[model samples]
Every structure is written in structure tokens, then in C-alpha cells.
Target: MKHLTYFIIFFSSINLFGQVNYSGFIDKYPIELSADINTSGNSYGVYVYTAYDDPIVLEGNLQKGKLIFFEKNSKGNKSASMTFEKFNLDSESIEGIWKDLKNGKELKITLSKKNEIGDGIIQKTSIGDRYFRIVADDQNVSEIKIFQKKTDKLIQKLKVDCQFRGVHCISTGDYNFDGITDFSIFESSYAGPNTSSLYFLYNPKTKKYFESGFSGTSLEFDAKRKRIIETNQCCAGSSVTTAEYKVIKNKMILEKERCFKWSEKKQELIERKVSECR
Candidate 1:
């Protein structure tokens, strides 16, 4: 197992004159905008967000405090475009006129500095002598970092690129019977209605948290039994599988597995033992 650290700074400050970095909602629209202007280079990177779709990135140039950008859909066609005119950062509220090129509509746009925790959320937990922080963005967990509580020396950081809804983010508990707390984050599958999770178990001997090979959808950590029970629906409610695991020599070993399937004639669930482990 490997422990790695990754860092990404989502915010930037205005250094050069006429350059602005603003993140806020578009006035009267259900959309969010994060714009970065580089007056020195005459370039900008803008990100537009909506609830149902992923964030769209647009690149363009700025001239005389006016920023223009365009976005393309997944099919490589021009989906929409925006033009921000009179982008003034000196006012108490950053206001401008946003022109929608595709719809031929112009809107009043107001922007503000984004809150630190608005886009990304952070939580702290402990495992034995180590303290860890979990950071999550809108789409998925961005990173997991471990550090010493006393010295504040960072031990490791792992950058995760998993897509998950923001509702059920991450959890921490002692699941491996190592007297150290472990962490878990759910990763949803893109193709189907299934979700798999990632577990990081703490190693007391090495003073590091290693990624467990175990993965499942619904995970229940049994501290008393020192086991992890996972259940997932198979074949669109026709069958389901449940597996139990225990930590043995710093590894998750499957102890037992049972599957249940719908019996058409009997109108009941038929039980069968399964030997597969995931």
C-alpha cells in the first residue's frame, strides 16, 4: 500500500491590475460562475455550474475589462456563450452585464468572493495517534490527508477522483480491529444504479493508513464482531448478495457470503451460498 499527498488550491487572488477572480451566482439564474481574469495575459478561465450537469469550463480572452467565453457540449457543438462587459472589481459589489449569445438574452450579473467552505467541505477525524482531514467537493471527495495532531506534521495525502453525491459523504470508525479508526467514502457507478466504496484502514504498526482492497455498496462496520458486512442488489432486484469480512494480518478476508434470488414459481426468496469475494 502507498500513502500519497496531493494538494489543489481552488481559489486565487488578484495580483495584477484589471485582473479579477470572482465566484458567485449569476443574477436571476440558477447557475454559478467562477471566473478568473488575467489582464496581463489577456486570457481567462471561466467555470459555469448547474445542478443537473457537471461544471463546464470555458476559455477566452479579456479586452478592456470585457470577458467573452464559449462552451461546447459533449457532442462538440457550441452549446452556449457568455459575454461579461464592464467587469469592475473596485465597486462594493462586482456587477456587470452578461450577454447570452445563443439565446440573445442579456442579464444583470453580480459576483462576490466565494466562501472557503462553499464549494469544498472539510471534516476532521482521528485514528489512534494520527489525525486526518477529509475534503469533499460537489462531485466527490477531493482528498484525504493524515497529520500528527501534536506536531501538525502532515504524514500523507491521497487525491481521490471518485464521483459521489454530496448527501452521504464519508464516515470514520474502527472497522479492522486494529484499535485505530478507519475511513470510508462511497463512489457511485456512472453506468448503473450501483455504488462502490473505498476503505482506508489504519495500520498501527506502520503508523500509516493503507487502502483496503475491499469495496462494496452498502457497508456496515461491526465494531463488536470486528467485521464488515456489505449487501448489494444484483440483476435489478431479482437477486441480492451479502458478504462478511474480517481483518486478518492487515488484510480483509471474506468469512462468509450468502445470496438470495426471487423464485418465480415458489413466490419466495431462494437462498444460495456464494464463493465470490469483491
Candidate 2:
């Protein structure tokens, strides 16, 4: 278990693992999990992937993983265990349909039932902005599937147009500062009509596709000189409105419409209004 993938999202208050940064783009991968009580069954419940063409759409059961205890050893002829799951995407892809965990210090029982993989950085964005994602609904609800963590076969599959099986995906950062990376979106419809939106669509320099604002749940961008950052969340609240739209030289400048701010550097949960346009 060298660390790769395990995403289980249950934020009743969140605190079993660590790291939870959700604003625009968020990619934190030290994906890890380990367990061993070998007897022979050769324990296994894994998720380690890196065959990227599309499939990276994980966000349910916070992505699913379950590695309970294993028993049958000492000669009982069954306790030979092996449960080492991993998923880490170079820090973080899926553009077709799109959709979106881990633990233990160590408990090795290596028996060649080997498992461990790689990949990283799937978040960091800018430019017209919009990228936030999460997904879940099955995989035993936590058997493990954190976006390409070894193919149960599901890439960008969030039907109902992301109405929320639990936590759907799309949120990474670069904010038009131009380093390249922006696919912002964070939606949670809670079953009723919770509501969420934010999709700027990739535009890595004339790369194409663009659309911003409406009920854009969360968005942020930076494309070298081009810039955009956004946050608009309303699950079913009242007439909540905080505006800011920037595109300048190309059109879309509201400069600042609604009013609200608490960006002590950008630690905002709500209340937003920062605009610019050309």
C-alpha cells in the first residue's frame, strides 16, 4: 500500500481521515489503505488505477472501500491475508460523461497478491472557470472506487445530470493565471431539488468550450492573464444572490453586482461578489 486511491465521503462533520479543501479546485492524493491478518484467503479489497483515456469519475460511498478483518492462519489454513488498496492521480480526468478514501498506518502480509499504483494532480484551475466533482450510489457503498482506482468500469457516469447520488464531481484550480487546468463544479441535489452548477468547460488557450453562471455552485479560473473566480451556492434557500463576472476583452463584465464578502484569502463558505469584465 504505497498510497494511491480511496475516497469515502460522509461529512456528518467529516473526520476519520483528513484533508477537505472545497472551493474551486481540490486535488489531494496520498490515497492509501492497509490491512493484513493472513491465513490464506489472501485478503483483498482494492482500488488502484492509471489507464487514463476517460474513466476518472468517482464520487459515491465517497467512492467506495471496505477492508474489514481477515482470519484463518496459524495453520488453520485460512488466515493468510492481503488487503492493500491504493489510488492517487498525480494530485488528478474524465470528459465524456463525467462523475467522480483510506487508512491504517500499516499491517503488511505480502503474499504476491500484490497491489499498488500511481497518478496525481487532478485539480488547479482558471479561465471562465468551473470544475467540481463527486459521485456515489454503489460499489457496496464503500468497497472502493475513487476515480479510476482499478476499473469496476465507470468513467464520468453521473446520470440525472448530476442530481446527487451522494457527492458528485468537478472542482480544480488555476483561476485564469494560466498554468492550465480548470473544470469547476460542485453539486448536491439531496434528492429533492438541492441545486448546484458551475461549468466553464476547458479552454486552455483557444482550446474551446465556455459557459459560466446561472446557479454556478462553485467556480475558479486563471489562464495566465485571463482570470475568473466564482462561488454561487443555493440548495433551496431564499433569494440568495452574490454576483461577479469577468471576461474583459471578450465580454462578461459585471464588475460587481450583488454584495457579500469574507475572502480572508479565499476561505469562503457563502456570501460572494467579486467582478471584472472586458
Candidate 3:
């Protein structure tokens, strides 16, 4: 009897150390799962959420087929040890056993596979009830598609010409305060220090993203102040010109202008205000 008990305990210890293969699962499946860790105290808390549901707060570590952790409530005061069992991953779904520690309630949870856009990095934003997915392939954005989350209907498709290597070159926000999300792409000149930017403004009347006539180098949008700023360098960076514009009636109206030039006598930069908006 003593030898049999030792063998049972040894087998259980081997099963407890099994780990979930996160990288292999994400690569083979078209799903995204985000885990946020908060290490405010000695015990680290984790919040797990899929693209479909709200985050579930749990203070636990995974061991084999068990999630050994504490479940935290919304108030952050109450916690109980929650052990999830039967955690299994297959080709189409992730099956697990979810248990509520406080009340000793258990439920089976299965996460099904969902389709994603392109293989590139996906940047998502919402305008009202509609959501837009922007997929970028390295330096170039190959596709931009807008769809309704409820019905999965493709509303609009836009092909952009701007190409930049960095992810910061593309952004989406309500630049014009029109209650619609707009997109901007910044493209840098390959041979020069100059940059060119393009804007796609969302038109509610037409229900589409229309290309605005506004184009500039070194373009930036001040979302908090609702202003557009542009800067241009001339004479090989010897002189710099800056302009501020406000969007009015789908037009960028210049509001202020300033210029900076290198002073040969002072061996420094000098600033001057321009009276003309251009």
C-alpha cells in the first residue's frame, strides 16, 4: 500500500507541470487572445480576454490542465481560489473547465476559431457601430476594409498609395470632429528629407471615406485642439516653414504661419512670423 501511494503521487506531479503551447496555437489558428498582467503586489494578477468577451480577472498560474489561481471580483476586494480543469486545445477549439471558487460552480468553456483579416498586423477602430480593419504588409498597407461587426458586411474598400516602413506612419482618429473616424498615411521621400501625407476623411452623407484635397509634408493632427499642423524645410534644412490649419466645411484653412532661418552672422537659428497664410 505504501509503494502504490508513492506511485500515484509521482504521476500526479508529472501532470501538474505541463504548460500550454501559446505560440504554436496562435500560429496555426486564426484567433487572438490577449493576457494582461498586473504585478502591483507580491501576487501577480492576470486578466484574460478574447476578441469576443469581456476580460475575466484571475489571479492564477496555469499548470498542466489546471488553472490554479484566485478569481477577483469587480470591487477588487474579494478573491477565491479557482481551479480550472480539463484544459485542452485542438485544431478548431480550446476546451476548458471553468469553476467559480466562491460558490463551487463549474461550467465548460469552449472558444471556437474565428477568422482574421490578412496575415499582416491589424489595426482596428470603430466609427459608431461599424468597425474598420487596416492591414499593413511591412512598409506598405495592402488593404483597408470597413465592415459591420453584427452582420459582417463589407461596407467600403480603399487602396492607399502611401508606403512607410514604420507602423507610426498610419493612424486613425476623428481629425475633423465629424463624429467619424478618419485615416492618415505619411510617406517619406526616399532620396530627400521631405515627407508627404494623405488624408481620407469619412463622409457620413455618402457613407464612405473620401480623399481630402489636403496634402502636405510633415503633417500632424492635433486631436485635442482640433488643428492640423504642417512643417516644410527648404534650402537643405537651412530654412524651416510651419503652418497651422483648421478644418472648416471639409477644407483646411490656414490659421498661422511661421518661418525659421539660419542666421550666418549669429551662427544660430532665427524665427520670424509670416503675415500670409501660405
Highest TM-score: give the candidate number: 3
Q: Is candidate 2 or candidate 3 better by TM-score?
A: 3
TM-score, candidate 2, is: 0.25
Clashes within 3 Å, all models in order: 2, 100, 1
Query: Compared with the true structure, what per-residue lDDT tens digits does model 2 show for residues 138-216?
Result: 2111111113333323323222233222222344454434455544444443322233544444454665436444343
**What are the C-alpha RMSDs, in order, of all predicted structures?**
16.1, 19.0, 17.2
Give me the displacement of residue 71 in model 1, in angstroms. Answer: 41
**Which consecutive 10 residues in model 3 have the weakest lDDT in total?**
1-10
Q: Which lDDT tens digits does candidate 1 get at residues 149-176?
A: 4454678887776653332345677767
Which ten contiguous residues of candidate 1 have the minimum total lDDT? 1-10
**What tens-digit string does per-residue lDDT give for candidate 3 at 118-215?**
52222323455555444554346666666654455778887775563322344677767676788766554522355676778987788788778887
Order the candidate numbers by lDDT, best to worst: 1, 3, 2
Off by over 4 Å in 3: 1-30, 33-121, 124-129, 135-138, 164-169, 189-194, 223-226, 234-236, 272-278
Name the runs in model 1 displaced over 4 angstroms: 1-120, 124-138, 147-155, 189-194, 273-278
Question: Deviation in angstroms for 55 in model 1?
Answer: 28
The whole-model lDDT of each prediction reads: 0.57, 0.31, 0.52
